[model samples]
Target: MNEEVENAFLPMTSVSSGKGSLVIHDVYCYTNQIVNICFINIPNNKWVLIDAGMPKSAEKIIQGAEKQFGKGSWPEAIILTHGHFDHIGSVEALAELWNIPVYAHQLEFPYLTGEQDYPPGDPSVDGGLVSEMSPLFPNHSIDITEKLNPLPADGTVPLLSDWKWIHTPGHTPGHISLFREKDQTLIAGDAFVTVDQESLYKVMTQKKEINGPPAYFTMDWDEAKVSVQTLRDLQPELAITGHGVPMSGNELTRELNKLAENFDTLARPDSKT
Candidate 1:
């Protein structure tokens, strides 16, 4: 298949989240700015890519993987937490180049398969420049129909037996987070994040604060709150979210609980679109 990627957005250099992985590697991206992606290492040099970073980032994703697992290594599969532009930006390019399948929650299929586009980001939500700039961000869906696959009904994840995918929507209908029962490590995606994503400074500094998902792109406030509470119930010892540095231990626990309990004040928008 012949594929062409049109990158009209600004491009910034990639940065590592510097969180130091136990089971995951953080490959950060800039769309003109920054976001996070996870490359999870499984046994035998095989791994999985979770949430493609910013638009036009396939090269950075591949390079980050090779740096971790050595040359010529590709993931067994690419699993998306959601179909938002930042999360699935380079999906088509990476999936096609690697000749691998991309898996996402069944509800996310429409967005991934060229069937639907996400609602526009709500720039009215709180934040500064980032939130204000969001209305200009892409909400259009990309078609990767041929390589897209629905996540397993049984909840088991491919290539990583120790981990299971948990349905944690709200940020998007089909959003999911990966959990490892053994260590209680959670890849929370955008269900929640470690930074106040609405703030451009915090994002670039990789600040470590437990906050709700990115406000501009998140449409369902109630579902997002529920998702945060559900994840808090997991009591993740370590959390690697879609943005910011990895947070862990009592700090992670304490902040996550606070966010879940006071989601309205901390996460909910003053006024939504």
Candidate 2:
């Protein structure tokens, strides 16, 4: 690992099984809110990055990849569950460096291609400081039209055969999650997060809680609940979310189930339409 980049985010954490068949690396980005950029390493030194964290995180992401697969190796493709600013922060830079395509859901085309702007984050919707400060989050679009490829309508993500991408919008118009049927490993983007992102203290400490996306950025509470329930039904054995450490076993399953069962109680916005 690049000591400099790894140390940039102190108390950096990662989880891997000794079986060694599949590995997930967490590249933590400490920014407006802490974000977790997960990279999955498969056999033959090949890998796929789930999301780009904050701006200027490309180097750290590359560093983490190299630590596992040797230097100068690039993923076959960069898959984005959404085009939210934090998630796509270093996408353009990384794609330029690797000369590889960036894949996103078809519904996300507007944001990725600079065709439309996402609704402004609703700071008034919640009381937390992060929610109250949401007005500062970027709502503008990123110009990466040339580098983006539409995900397959069949839901299979390219280069990752064992996994399927599920549409889980609400945090953004086109948010998504990845699931491996064989092992039930899920890479849930912001459809739901594993942290109480609105609290600076929880974020800094990497506290684990299964919650919805940052309240400020989440537009529709009802849809968000449905999205979470859809994911819970998959009964994933392991999950790596966008904002918390990877979770697994009965604990992860129980939390997901609770989130699904009481999504409205836990994640719905107070200001209902």
TM-score of each: 0.90, 0.87
lDDT of 1 at 42: 74
Candidates in order have lDDT scores of 0.78, 0.73
Instruction: Give the per-residue lDDT of model 2 (tens digit) for 1-273.
Output: 122222332222223111112333422222223666666656676777777766666777677666657889888888998877778877888988998899998888888777787786677766776676666666667777888899999999888877899999888878889998888888888888887877766766767889887788886777788889899999988887877666788998899999899777788766754
Each model's Cα RMSD: 3.1, 5.8
Best prediction by lDDT: 1
Which lDDT tens digits does candidate 1 get at residues 195-261? 7788777777666788899888886888999999999999999888887777889999999999999
lDDT of 1: 0.78
234, model 1: CA deviation in Å?
0.6
Off by over 4 Å in 2: 1-33
